[model samples]
Target chain A: MSNLSKPIPPAGDQDALEVEIRGKTFRGADGDAVRAIDEIAFSVAPGSFATLIGPSGCGKTTTLRIILGLDREFDGRLKLPAGGGRIAAVFQEPRLLPWRTVEENVRLALSDEDTGRDLDDLFAVLGLAEMRSRYPGELSLGLARRAALARAFAIRPSLLVLDEPFVSLDEQTASRLRTLLTDVWSARPTTALMVTHNLREAVQLSDRIIFLTERPARMRGVYDITTPRADRDARWREATLPALAKRYSGVL
Target chain B: MAPDHRADATDTALLQRPAALGRPVFGPRLVTALSLAGLLALWWIAAIVADSRVLPAPPAVAEAFWRDAATGELFFHLAMTLMRVIAAFVLAMAIGSVIGIVLGMNREANRFFDPWLILFLNIPALVVIVLAYIWFGLNEAAAIGAIAVNKIPNVVVTMREGARTLDRDLEEMASVYRFSAGRTLRHVVLPQLQPYFAAASRTGISLIWKIALVVELLGRSNGVGFQINLYFQLFDVAAILAYTLAFVAVMLTIEFLLVQPFEAHSTRWRPRRAGS
Candidate 1:
């Protein structure tokens, strides 16, 4: 169902993000042409949580980069309809400016119109209120991730992109951050497209999951979780995830 | 299970007890004082053994210093040298940083200018000073210009490296946020380059001052360098030593009072050393 070449007519829908990568090629160190992405097409619906799941080095990050407009050399199109909404991203690494305080780092994301808008509430939601004056280097890894999340959400972004924001963290910290993500996300719902390899994490956080194959990635399948987010708690995930994994066993 | 906090506290106390007992009796200031006194004693012994006019004793140098101070000659020359140093240092840093950033950002420009930079870097300080005096006709402008030119290449080299090593991740973050050019340069680019700026300034100050003396000796009518030149002709070793010592002390004072504090403040966000 997700293989359509054209976007779902983006004229009136300002909140949806449409991405189509016909091909993305770059020359490698050995001067050989390497195709990083091959004919992947997806659209994020308004205010929905979508995740792209794949193995490591599967061009997930490259896809995210293209969608975020960081890498414009790709032979593709990323269409965000003309509107008031902006784009924000949480990269794999917490890319906070080490020299600035947490407050400064977050404020750097704020556009002119967003300036002077009170952030105390947002900070409180992310547990970053007391951390406002501290530098990124002084913060623990978990705190740094939270700060990155805060920076992304600070802009009230219409389309949010996340690149494995919880990878490399301990299980406990990652779970807590996942919960914190949902809390912040629900407070002000936006169209979120996240990239993750962990299937359970995808199941826990996403409304739709788009699976991708290995390097030179192609879409494997797109799955939608019908259960309401509030109902998909520990017991539900435990009961449903094994069968779900089995269903996608070939792709996994 | 977590380790017992009470037991951990007791262990920490036991570990710290020996450190407290083994702490040195002499403080840093006292140690510095003793070292300087030992050096002075050694100098006095060397003077007695040599007993020559060339290697003047500590007392002789001090007497020369006092004589110059009482005559107001010391203040005038010191002030002259200080002014030249400040002017040249600022000029070099401003010109070098702009050029360095430009070259670093544009690969084509860097390729074009790389040979020019190397040429300037290798040109001896003496030659630059001589050329400046000859072409510009031995004025204050020439003297300051020569000193600044002598130091600009070093600043450019350091700042270029700093610009090249800037964190691309942070830069991408800035762009994704749609930061204005001014905002990105100030908040993202400049902070990353502060350490490099600090290094350039430290080296620039030392290099510029030395070149400034040469510039002064070649052309200027009044500075520590000129005074040293005047004493050189008379074979007055004591006078030359006095002037050199006074200028060195002032530079050292500036380093301690200004440069070190600025460096420390800029990197205040970095993880501090243990016990600092």
Candidate 2:
């Protein structure tokens, strides 16, 4: 089956996450202590998409890192579901190997369960089919971003984490990529956590949006979206943007 | 660099590369031939002006090269030196990379061994050669050992920097993808270190070439260095130049044919700058 069509859940259930952050602190390089996150707790039920929106540098990326088990030096209880499913991430940067061609980069993410059949379709879906043989250095930032997405999705991830995946992109490309992301995402039943600065992106794609406070982040609110992500058209976002903009005017 | 995409590396398959540089049919060899001829012309003129046998003319050196090569002594010594060089290069690279990777990967290890690395880096190559001979006596093993020992610290420094500068984002991507250790090393780690490896190898060959000669000259009875020592005692400047020129020609061949091509291949993914 094309991983582009729909990803098979490692567990019958799409992944569930229960996160609790009491006090996460770290010592900086100069030995000064800083509190990054504080009492920012939230959860995503199986097969739901959630976005963490906060002021820049309010530890949203750090929170994603904590969930992915990349950072352990924190006081937190991040309880992911039991079944061993693949976890995939698209970091803020493309982070692709300059030497490895796009195909090889995607191949590195394949697991035992992955049949390696969806590569072509995945590339085609992400607008990277023709450029699969090119190295990362040979790619533009937009194309590189698509390759990163292809690599993440190639593994048939149960837990999809995107950390500012569309930052620094022009609006046209970002819109196209976001649409591409939502189409690919909605095709499969997977739990996704995204750290984004875009309010419209959160409103359109997320089933729930968790608003976080300033540094040493604490959740201000978590709003459940009634509109189906697939059905969220331009009208829905047009109507939704101003209201949310006014609502988060003080925090954002 | 880019206007000639087809001429350089285009959509060529990387692994099954037939040629290392993918260089176009150009005058690269011709340029080199011209430069060598120029050097020989200048040397011939200088020899004529000096009118001294101490700096023998090109023909005199070529005759010496022919005589030694005909006697088979040149081949034997060259073979011996080549073996020691290859053996030492491999040994130093292996041991130095291991130590370097360890120090780079672990903070505790770096803290413990950094001072030692600095100390060895500052030590003279001559000091290492004499000490190795003193410790192990004048044998082939001691000669090879001295060259490798002198080489290890530099390789370690280079590899350590390579390991340290490894991209953390890529590592996180590897972990998030759950890449196996073997696969990660092959794909994610090794490619990042290619430039550093090239740096180490380029510097290594030049350094090892000089050191191995000294090691041979000091104690060993075979190889280019020992042969040069014998020619020096006889004041046979022609013989010395012949052996030296042969060694130099071989080194230059290795540099152009092997090192230059390998470097080009390693960094092929990098985008070209404007013009040549």
Candidate 3:
């Protein structure tokens, strides 16, 4: 159901490769240093969806920030593919410019040539076409989140990083947005990495799930969901998924 | 999501409703006219009770005003006073805004000017006017300069605060979008700076008028303050009362016609929260 009008290069054809993090430690204030993501070595395959799940303060956000070049002081070597295209992030908050209209907020992320996508269609996909002229203050929380999603997708980034993107959304809106996000990723197939506390969301959205241990996080487990793309139905409620949930519940 | 359909429907219905009737057009004007009438009545009553040349009745003040108007003397002096005040205010705004913006951007410059600006703010207007007259020999230049200098400190303080509170997020957005300096100034900076500018103008206008009056009384040959001085020398209480009432009327008109409208326009974007 993707409505991308123009041909976008495959994630592989663009700069598709792996991001490796080696022994990253982040120190908080009060002179107490926590070795967040110690000796964490993982590779994000191009055109694959990966989800990082762990307890709160388990270095999920820190890992994502390190990959995004936002946290450079960490002791790690992050190997990104050559000639990285636009890297756009969907923050936990919508972070839409309060003064701009919804349409303008989405348009702000796009270059001149990338504006070829039908804005009306994009908004319609997110159920936001009618609210295009409304400011962020005028929009409901769901619509604002949809606007933020549309903005992230509008830029067509090679790497799409989401940090608890749907934390505060109601279940129905969150589910709808999750479906829309899957459809968008399936179309363009960007190297997507999302960090979530919800195991159900991780199972539903990710090709590979990486679970982390408590504070000074380490990769406790990795689950490769072998479910075929077409046959995965109610993936979170599947019989085998519970076993995996029971297996990783303690680390979380 | 089950959209808050009920709330949306109510908002839409509110938007569709016919506009409310316009406000009563003459309410404020009527209130002002009545208040002025009350003040005149009080003056007349006081004059009748005092029964001396120290206080003049409304009719006596009116006669004095009419005599001056007929001779074109009142208009000439009023015009001269207004011209000096306007010139001084303009110069103060220009110089103060420039200095304030520079100081706001540079911490070192702000520190350098902090003591000096505080000194200017604290000095009495009458003392400054006397000093200007003594230093510059009672010329028009000296009169206007004194008023301008007295007004600049207030404008500088206001503009500096405005610059300090500017949103860094908005600036970053502008930078990411590669907006030119002119566009950034026009759209982002100026809109944010509007409240400060409006405040500066309001305070500056009132101050310019007060300082201009002091300068005229001390040194200048023409203007309302000079005419008041002349009336005092002749012991003409009626003339003095008429001139004072006329200046108050001018100040009130400026407040209503210019400052109020500008303030409303500039702050329209600010949201009104509940209980505000």
Candidate 4:
């Protein structure tokens, strides 16, 4: 939901490694072959939270996929930091194994060697201990998303990528999840990138917001969120976030 | 609001503690048993009134059953038939499951064998049995082989379709997590394939029995079908009806006790939908 069109001036500050995507484009299905994403570049710092906001069909999800190595056909050099640590993703859908229990789904993300943490504590953090044995089909949308969050965090990821992970939840549920996410992020600060069109959510959770253009999406803007993460409450809608929303609504 | 209510109800239902004493002894099952007894009494009355040899009285059939049982003829034939069916079923399942998984996993293998499967499925059971007898001779091996061959294609088709529809996301997740192949097969793939295995077992059991009977009648020297053929030669309608009823009873017991229970157990983990 962070829609703004202010160009990010290249600052001298260089605490984090930058992900530079040059001439990145994808071919569409029709013989006409329209570009879905065009040369999008951005940098996310270690332990910093960033959100990508764009109109529907603006290649926000596509950009995330390029980084995840899921879309190798796209043109460009998608550089990651040397000695790239494990990257965990929460897809737009929960994508939980329908046959598996909630705990089993979380356990699926853990490697055999990484066994320092107790699963119960992880489930407790997400308020999902009682629902551990339940299958995905049995869970409500909010609980399913919580389970997904638990699964991603259980990996102890160095980078967490989420694609509209809470879009289907009710406002109250989404707010609760946002608080849980921030708490989890605070506990073990990892570089986080979330894609969402919800401007309030972007401003509430992210350190910076990256906005993209309409269909052949390129970076339309980047806004350094001045709101301190500790002061932000997911329940309250901010007046300034809507101003950014209004600006990008026209450009997108 | 309705979806919220439904979800809350499911959560509550799942939270409820299981009964400590298990299910009560007296229930609808007892009522159903009584109703079945009542039906049998009515049938007995009708048979007495009709005084027909073709539709032999229940007591007369019972007497025939007793006579066969007393002579050990019933056990011998039943055991023989059951052994052949069991052997054929196990072989069919083992071969069918392997072939099915292969076909399911590889598109090229599926395409290669699909026409052959269709060809076998379409062929008459009688022709297949006769061909087996001609090729292998009128023996136990020939009879069992015929039944096994007839059953394999159906099992293969069921298992192949089951394998084809497996959740790709789960497979990818398994690979991402670096789950051992054995663990993935045991916990993930096998559980997903349960319904298909159940379907195959159900269909396979029914088909194998029917085909086994035909094989016994045409090629084998012993078993229920051979005995029925012998009774037909002697014009013993009572014996025939008794044996037929006995087989039907056996089939029903197998369905309720074996197949249904197995199916239910395998699918117990699948979450029930609201209003289901």
Using lDDT as the measure, the top candidate is 1
**Candidate 4, true inter-chain contacts retained:** 0.30
Q: Give the chain A TM-score for each candidate.
A: 0.91, 0.91, 0.88, 0.86
Worst window of 10 by summed lDDT in candidate 3 chain B: B1-10
State the interface C-alpha RMSD of candidate 3: 4.1
Q: What range of 10 consecutive residues in model 1 chain B has the weakest lDDT sum?
A: B1-10
Clashing pairs in 3: none
* Residue-by-residue lDDT tens digits, candidate 4, A1-252: 011122211222213436556555655566566678776889887678999988988888878877776667776665453235566788877878777788887876676555444777778888998999998889998998888888888876666789998897889999899999988877766678999988778888998888888878888889887767776653434556567768777532
lDDT, candidates in the order shown: 0.87, 0.85, 0.77, 0.78
For model 1, which pairs clash? none
The interface root-mean-square deviation of each model, in the order shown, is: 0.7, 0.8, 4.1, 2.4
* Alpha-carbon lDDT of model 3: 0.77
Please report how far candidate 1 places residue A142 from its true position, in Å. Answer: 0.7
Give lDDT tens digits, candidate 3, residues A1-252. 122344565556655446556566656687777677675666667778888888999889888777766667776566554365566677777766665678877876676555555677678877887988887877777777788888877776667788898898889988888888887678667778899998878878888888888767877888887775556676535875679868987533
State how far residue B113 of model 2 sits from its true place (Å).
Answer: 2.0
lDDT of 1 at B141: 96
| lDDT, candidate 1, A24-113, per-residue tens | 887999999998888888887788899999888889999989878888898877876335357889999999998889999998788775
Better by TM-score, candidate 4 or 1:
1
> What shift in Å separates residue B269 of candidate 1 from its native position after superposition?
0.5
Judge the docking of candidate 2 as incorrect, acceptable, medium or high: medium
State the fraction of real interface contacts model 3 keeps.
0.00
